[model samples]
Target: MGLRGRWGGRAAIALCVGAGVWLLVTALRDGWGRADPVASVFGSVAGLAALVLALRAIPAPRPPVPRPVPPEVPEWWVDRDEADAVVRAVRRRTRRWRSGGSVAITAGLHGAGGFGKTTLAKYVAAQRSVQRRFPGGVHLVTIGRDVRGPAAVAAKVAEETRLITGDTVETGSDPERAGNHLGSLLAQRPRTLLVIDDVWEHEQLAPFLRGAPHSCVRLVTTRKT
Candidate 1:
């Protein structure tokens, strides 16, 4: 709660408590046995109001709100020609799959840390041609060294894809089940583009690759070749 809200609640509670105490004291001083019925009733009401106010003064927990996912498009991109070149290359390599073939296309963009590999991948994924080709939509997952392991990576992808049916794959502990579930979901889709970014090891890509559709195009970005 804000400062204003807290102060307001405290003031309300104080007023109620003070009123209740004053009424009880007045009733006792006048001798409750001889007190008027109206005085007794006022005292009871004031005490109840004070008790309710005190209870309300205690804070209740707020429910958690889901965070909004960031958009795939970059805020500002430099070197449009470079991004276009990479996009064209990706399209050329994956063109065979668009012709009713079941070949899975994989491309790696390896460079130094700040070389904008992820940005380029986002640009490619956002292309009209790419979107038109993959009707299932483009999904991006970040699996850096900080990511626990294959299981964690799988769980993250599953969450991003909204594939969590129950507690089967919470926190990505069951990689096999998560991978299989994800794969089954993707297999049902016609085509999809999976962009795996900031990968630190080749092994981290296994679970995601296992679930990807045969006609899907996988774009990987990493500092290592």
Candidate 2:
């Protein structure tokens, strides 16, 4: 008939075959005609009860969900109120940092380079509330030897912003141009958090922090005062 009907018929045949095999085995082991039917039934019932108890004792493994990519966003593993407060504080700090005046988030993060500043920044950026606040999305730039000048900073920011610096803005053309372009980008957004990690000098903080637009926030994670 149908595939489902065929499967059902096959299953029925398989079950019947299994039962017949079990009966034949039982008869061979205990002389079926000579054995007491009641005793046999009671033994079978007891065996089934033991089997069920054993099955219940064993723990079943949870099934895995197949997906193309795992979610990168952090699930709320903490209390809702605490999470909401953290998000609000972040947004508020973002606003304060973006303001014309210099604002510093001075928390004593122990250790040197190996300290978890970058990780914490990333986690904060990935927060659902922060993500919602900045629909333009978050950009992370790591400053190093290759990233010595303003041009490199612009290039990194452009990359983070998901735009080619040459095609969209000329931050890489010159230091002043790069600074202006970066500032403009930061200012253009309604709410953006610009994080500068592992700073070595007070001068390094000046360009990115100074004269930035009120729209975006600048967050610096530095070792020095």
Most accurate candidate by TM-score: 1
lDDT of each: 0.67, 0.52
Name the candidate that leads on lDDT.
1
| Candidate 1 TM-score, true structure as reference | 0.57
In candidate 1, how many Å is residue 42 off?
A: 72
- Native RMSD of candidate 2 (Å): 20.1
Candidate 1 lDDT, 98-215, residue by residue in tens: 5766664677889998888888888787778777766666667777887677666666766755632222335356666666777776676667667889988766776667755464
Of candidate 2, the 10-residue stretch with the lowest lDDT total is 62-71
Question: Mind giving the per-residue lDDT tens digits that candidate 2 earns over 1-225?
Answer: 555555555555555555556667767887787345744564566556555554554556434312112125446333334335445665776567546465554222223675655556556666777777654444444444445655555555555433311235434534445556667655654565555666665544555654444555555666665
Regions of model 2 farther than 4 Å from truth: 1-88, 94-111, 149-167, 171-173, 202-204, 210-212
- What TM-scores do the predictions have? 0.57, 0.47
TM-score of 2: 0.47
Where does the lowest 10-residue lDDT sum fall in candidate 1? 163-172
